[model samples]
Target: MSMREINFDGIVGPSHNYAGLSPGNLAATRNAGHVSHPRAAALQGLEKMRANLRLGLAQGVFLPQPRPDHAWLDRLHQRYDTASPHLKAQALSASPMWAANAATVSPAADTADGKCHLTVANLMTMPHRSHEWPDTLRQLRLAFASGAFAVHGPVPAPFGDEGAANHMRFAAEHGRAGVEVFVYGERGGPFPARQHREASEAVARAHRLDPARTLFVQQAEVAIAAGAFHNDVVAVANERVLFAHELAFEHRDAFYADLRRLMPEVEIVEVPDARVSLADAVSSYLFNAQLATLPDGGMALILPGEARANERVWTWLQELVAGNGPIRRLEVVDVRESMANGGGPACLRLRVVADPATVDPRFLVDEAKLDRIAEIVTAHWPEAIEPGAIGDPALIAQVEQARAELLRALDLVELLDS
Candidate 1:
């Protein structure tokens, strides 16, 4: 069987809310305390998955880890009322809905060895997200236990790691060995640069990636301060094509030069400053798009609805797709529920390239599975959640019960207790 890239999107959790915990995330801080509709969010996600499947793209799904993570919080011995704001924020966060921050993946094709490798991110820079790796690893192992995959623990902390949000892979074909770009920031700006150079290197070593094939680049300081918290905020790549804002990297010339030297066939699709400023891109989330290779030998940009709402971005994208470019089509997905909390279409999913036989069968999905998931969401997920409700003990119990129903419905009961 041929290996292919599969987009594994995380289902929006029942506790999905706007805590505004992520410091550098533009969307999170901008829309703090907005009401969230859990049922609508999950249904929208399922519909997006169905849309991808209808387009003949390989789509996979992951269960959201139970939230207001009581087990992990219990270790600290602080009751809900006594917990500090940061601690409370950590417990109430729905940030896991943005699974791009979950881990960095290097497919078997890119690794020196033949086994696919995954490294869970520490996310140590943010109080709410720092506690995710432990629970995330538990689920990753449960779903990727096959011999074809290697799940590595998060890089030792004191070093921040933001995962695939800062990593991009490119090659002549989806299933072939590719050049992996690890974008890091040195924290020169006001907001912390989440992907530390040390963490990126650790992941590359864990995957046993060839030094020649792996390249490290620094994220633009301006981009970080302007809320391009992760590289995905300013860049995206699919196969041999990279769509990036000109200011995405600290040293743009050197970065592109390295790519040209290493991968001559690489196609550089830069959004120049003259066309659209970095500020507009961050505000519009123009770069937070899913770059998928269509079977027709063309590419498509799966953009968030917000992208269309932004006149500047929408105008540029319209011209780009209509012009002589690799990206020939556009699809807009409404992920406003999660998008309000600083995530977009790309943020909701993690792309893994491997054969169906290599991944745990439970993670794969079809039309039937989408219908079942939608039914569960409509039946059990909360219709609405408010920012102030995070403090309610009753809401916690409600979320816990809802997640239990979800686990049983998906036959992922192993994660229920986790």
Candidate 2:
């Protein structure tokens, strides 16, 4: 079987927020609502993505755990041999740190298959928001150019000025073939007065790539201006693009109606208004389900939003389950940290190539039988161990001990095939 590139938005550790409290002026004030503002949302987002990836694992629709976004790969991709002594030393230190401290690597448990795949992205980090690309891109390209991963250029539009323009130019100049550039309408502020055509033409000139083929959208706008563009998918262009909030009932209907009018023949999916928490959205969309392949055998629902928030994804899955068409299962990986910092699962994981080798044969679940499976998985949690309460050395030892214990518990889980 050929190794297929899996597109899963990897789960991010609460690094910016969950890593540890910051000491700078940006740190949260005393008695603040959260330990950190952006960090809090990022942690919540990470939790949701974890839930999604976990669900994918449980349902057998996903490969084993995803690759981390840290160090091992950085060493492989960096050219320390060509660097000056200072740069070489930096690479040397950085390489090991990436391996030790960074969390990116292929899954130990993932067996090769025609469909086995995985992907992960940095939590709460957008180039547009930080206006730190080129530099960020250099680091990312060094860290993640290996593993045949499809990389999405850093989204740096949330920052004011022509960040998006700069990002597009950068991608056009140096981006690999699969780089996707998704634009938002107005989160940091209102959309620039310049029209999409003007922006597209400018980016094309800067990057040297065809502007016609670049993926563009009106993200985060109050009123959807994209109804006119007969482009790809049109989702709920709201602030938080997840199930916790849905499109207004009237707006939702209108959005769909407009979509049909503009592109009657185009495949469309509408996001639903399910009030699932951010955590639940991440878990269900990323972890618990397999990516569903379209009948044409070309992947279509490859989006950068919540599974529940993209009506197209939900509809595609429903159609398959409803016997409406021919379908192949693809894994769905969520990578967003939360609505606060930016990004959804798609924003995180970039697909390198569609690997048929990464698909799990055991992917299946009866919603009716889900509760029973959860009960069995839950029973493995013993009340006897508390690593947080132990000494550092003892805690490390306990973790090793508990890992063995958990493996033993898996012996009782029928859902997990041996």
Candidate 3:
């Protein structure tokens, strides 16, 4: 079986709204209370998948998690009507649409058992996202129940794992054995540091990776303080190339030296601070772009439109493409709604290296499947959701029904019980 990287993007849920629940995520806070267009958001995500398909990339999708999580409210002993506004908002959060935080995946080549391993993240730091792992695990199990895969539950709480957002994998090729880098945070000044060091170690162990090939590095406090809540906001890695802002790690030189030692063929593409400051990098999500290996053996940076809007970012990108670099293509996509909510192209996807035939067919997509999903979104998803309308019984009903329609359309009714 040919093993290749398949990017599984999360479908934006009907509950997509701007509540500004994440403290360190600058964009989320800045866009709080703004009216959100769920229909538009989901469509944009689908369009991104379609573009990937056009590029000869394998694309899969994880459906939106059930919203207004009544199970969570029940644990709190409160109904939606009686719960405080804060609790209501948390229960209705659609943050799971960012699948990068869904799990930390170790491909078959990197694990001892020769099976792809996945560990769901316990987003324990943020109240709004802390309850996401259970549903995420359900989806993981259903999609990868083959003997070629092993899915583990989240690292116990207090470790605060944020999954792939803080993880980077470097390999000569997708199916080859590679080095895994886990970036964790210890400090962020006024904002809370989300990914904990212990959590990174725990995930590495759970995946049964060789400690020699696994590296743990601390995130630069300055980057985190500047709203780089996750390392992906400042750096991204694909195969041998490491594209990042210069200040992405606390010990940049040492990390680079270590990476080079482990993988002699590694290529480091550092964006200097003078060229694009940390603030601009975080805001533009320059490093959050998907650095994918194209079928022709070249690379492409699938960037959000914000990167093109930033003069410095766009200029640097044009120069990079014009040069003799591994990254030869720049594919710009519009995921503005997700960008406003603190997620970019990378955040919207979970990268899994496996034989496509091993995954559940329901999770994979082609042009026709996307058309069916888009039709459901247009017909049942709410056109707009006001910040104040999250808890209204009418809106809640609509959100639930919209997800149900998607499940039925995909023949994934089993998820309705999830």
Candidate 4:
């Protein structure tokens, strides 16, 4: 019925520590552009996301302040700057840029939201196991202790582990429910690093997260650059179960089968695919996710007449509402820019806190356009109309639908699941 807030997601680390020399990575660079500068590539990802999220607030995460404990990224960047053709080719062949860039995209919120929430990448800078996490965690914790949500990747490794778990536990203790841990991807970040995988699994176990939370997404394995994924996820600031499309396709049957087997009372919808590249997917997610809220009734509807790639976010939203899910208020808004990076209504958002129950809807309406919109839409398209005709339905619907579709085309879902 109404639209509000747009975010400019910032990017961080393309550090060598996360993604070092790998093979097959060269091709990804070529596919995106002709630059060896990983940071530039990361920027491309950020720009794409900015373009996709049309309706939410635009803000970005500042890069980690360079520090000794986090110096591995610096080393990697140094190497990338001076990488030998042989090494570069080898690294490129293996995968795209470094894995830590997965953490680059920073989450943002509206100025009025009252709290700062940050999304962090879960991958390690170096593959080596550690008794202690880098000091970056402590610094970040101290910096934004009062944040609304600190969304990050799984705490424990996929199968299970201790070191990262300790880091995650520390984060949890400091963060409380403000922390929402999500899984990266299925194949799991460049190269076949068994130790990293083991560590990730261990962290997951230590956190007592559902395996479904341990996403084996597609983008995490390839195109994602360190923090590129975070930008899109951080844009949204509402509470709802994030339904990842990549998860649905790669593991939907099992996820659903398991859900039915364990929590049958839960209703699920298989998110439809938007056939876009991974970078695009993250953008789409960030742009459209801001307006999402819990629905009011068992069958509240949130349908976008058109969105690219058949990304059925509106459909999923409808299903969630129909199931009487915890998400109670749903507001579908316009997102044209983020779709370029493969985002939709849900991809770009990062939920910081549930909205205050008594918040007024008048805040969302554009006072300047309300009367004019109502007059025009009511005069023309009635099928796509919202109650009371506060705004131009045809114009709003057309704009919103275009934004949603663009996100589906960009592969924001792939990035989200990853």
Candidate 5:
């Protein structure tokens, strides 16, 4: 029953391309219709995992969902060959690679049933992401099949749930009872607020989280309008530390008071707007980082390369690390491809606190496994994917075959049928 935090990153798919599907994500929209390098993207993700493993953290991976979801296309009464551009883009979307939007997880320590409960996100706000739940659920169930876990389906539609991207948990340690914070949104000027308050409440109840320990906070509308579409885009939490931008929440002071009441040991690391503006935070993905507790009881911020490039953000981070701060280390990774598509280090992972033994072995990985996965990516994944290449028969064949090869390599072929 030794519990630890395991990050399950979604492997960047062979169909990884930028069609500008997400409206509020500035990076995705800015780089829309640009050519994508699927092979390089997947390799970057794998190298990130390897870096984590080297840091003595347990790492896991979720396979890319089947592309050209023919069944979904058929349901829409449209064939890939004859469908409209918009419809075709939706069908071939690789948005699921951002695993933070995969589910909302409540560890066994916080749930009434003493089982880690994960509810799949409905993602109803965006047309391109709305259909991801079924496939996500399949992977969740298979990976967390042990009795120590309970995987639930998505919250009903009309109530958008974007999963862990909008959630944060703070505790003294990984195995202890913790306070879970669910961040929801009401309004964004032009962009749709993705995570609804109703959806957060539903997930809280379904996970059987103690109402006393669960807090619902509103995301700042201004931050959303500035391209912080999800809460994680402006904030991230690890153990007892909350590393966030000052404009992350609607009622920042009230939320801080309530969080302190729930967990007295909580540390709030708020970055002011003067230091790094909300626009800079979103564009550089400074807050969209993986704040992880190290094996030696220290903390580290696994940031994307963009964070290091921004002068303001980088200077603030350097000062924080140089001083006697909780986050002692800074590790910058090159996930430029994912960053271009609006996913940083935090966006690419789903954080689950559980005993490693409880999760399916097939999902967990070591350095050797990552190396094998990289081989498949180098051999099968497409080197470059143009926007118009999504619907091409040749590209589709290669995409499907690449995923099949990874599944076979990992001995997780059951997912092919799923």
Candidate 6:
């Protein structure tokens, strides 16, 4: 079977808004109370997917969860109201649109039983994200329904689990068995560490990964406090290269040493702390990029528009690509709507290494499908969304109807249920 990594990007929902729910997310906090362009956001995301498909890469799409998500409120025997700040915030969360946090994936090549593994994140750390896993699990299982995959639920909470945002895998090639790196964190400062060490180990064991091929690294508490709530905010990995901030981990040097021992051919491409401080890295989301292996054996950095706009980040990227680096080019995309909520190109996707033929055909993407999805977004999605307007019956009805239209466009009628 042919093998390649499929990037399943979340289709941005019509309820996109800036509620500033994530504590350490600088963009969300900085852009709080701002108006959002739901149609623009969805169209931009679709364009990104189309770009990847044109590159001969395996591109897929994940439908967004219904917004004004009153599921949790219904479970709690409560109704939507501004009785408390948290109550109001939960009803307006659009976090499920960032699919990276949905699950941690282990390629079939890396697992012991020759079956891929997927574990839906608990996401128990933030109020806005707490309700995402159950919905996410349903979608994942339906998409990867073949016996070739084994899907697991999150480790019961009180222990936070932020999926691939805190996970990275490295290998000699995209199709080979690789080393899985699970980054966990500790509570040290104002920001609550979202990924627990126990949760990392639990997922690794559940995936039946080889002990020798799995590793657990602790995220630096300082990074978490500096708005890097997720390890991905400071680090990202491709086939054999790691682009990370110097201070991303608790014991950075030791972690790298262990990684070298496990995978001797691995290359470390670090952004020096002196060049870009942790705060700037978090703010610019320099590390939150998609380092994709292009068809011609060269790598390209798929960056959000913000990275090129940041003086320090863009200057460094230009020099990096100009030199004899593996990253051959930069493809900047406009995911500003998602960027305003503290996620980037990397944040919008869940990567899976598998044979495309084995996955459900409905999840696969093509130019015709992309055009149809875009048509639906342009025709049905809300033009703009204000945080306060989320409580309006018209806005809720419009959002729900837009999501339904998208599902029908993609043949994902199963997700229309509560």
Model 1, CA-based lDDT: 0.86
Colliding residue pairs in candidate 6: none
TM-score-better candidate, 4 vs 6:
6
Model 3 agreement with the true structure over 222-332: per-residue lDDT tens digits: 999999999999999999999999999999999999999999999999999999999889989999999999999999999999999999989999999999888899999
The C-alpha TM-scores of every prediction are: 0.97, 0.35, 0.99, 0.38, 0.99, 0.97
Model 1, span 1-418: residue lDDT tens: 5788899988898888777877788788888878888889888888888878877788888787767777768888877666776677688777777889889999888787789999999989887888888878987897789888999999987889989999999899988888999999986467988889999999999999999889999999998988899999999999989999988999999999999998999999999888889888987788999999877878889988888998888999999988998889999998887778888889999998888877777788999988888888888888988877877778778878888887788788888777
lDDT per residue as tens, model 2, 7-121: 3332221112212111110111121122222223323333433443343322211111111221432544644334343332222110110110111222211212211112211
The CA lDDT of each predicted structure is 0.86, 0.28, 0.95, 0.30, 0.94, 0.87
Decoy 2 TM-score against native: 0.35
What's the C-alpha lDDT at position 265 in model 5? 90
How many clashes in each structure? 0, 49, 0, 109, 0, 0
Model 2: CA > 4 A from native = 1-14, 18-32, 35-135, 143-208, 211-217, 223-266, 271-343, 354-418
Q: Which structure among the candidates has the greatest lDDT?
A: 3
Clashes of 4: 109
Q: Best to worst by lDDT, what's the order?
A: 3, 5, 6, 1, 4, 2
For model 4, give the 10-residue run with minimal summed lDDT: 164-173
List the candidate 6 regions with Cα displacement exceeding 4 Å. 81-86
Give the Å shift of residue 161 in candidate 4. Answer: 11
Model 5 residue 282 CA deviation (Å) reads 0.6
lDDT of 6 by residue, 1-418 (tens): 8888899999998888887888878788889889988899889888888878877778988888977677888877777754354665676677887888989999988889999999999999887889888889998998999998999998897888999999999999978989999999986488788899999999999999999989999999889888898999999999999989998999998999999999999989888888888877887788888889988988988888888888988888888999887787888888888888888989999999988888998988899989998899999988998767867779888988988988887778988994
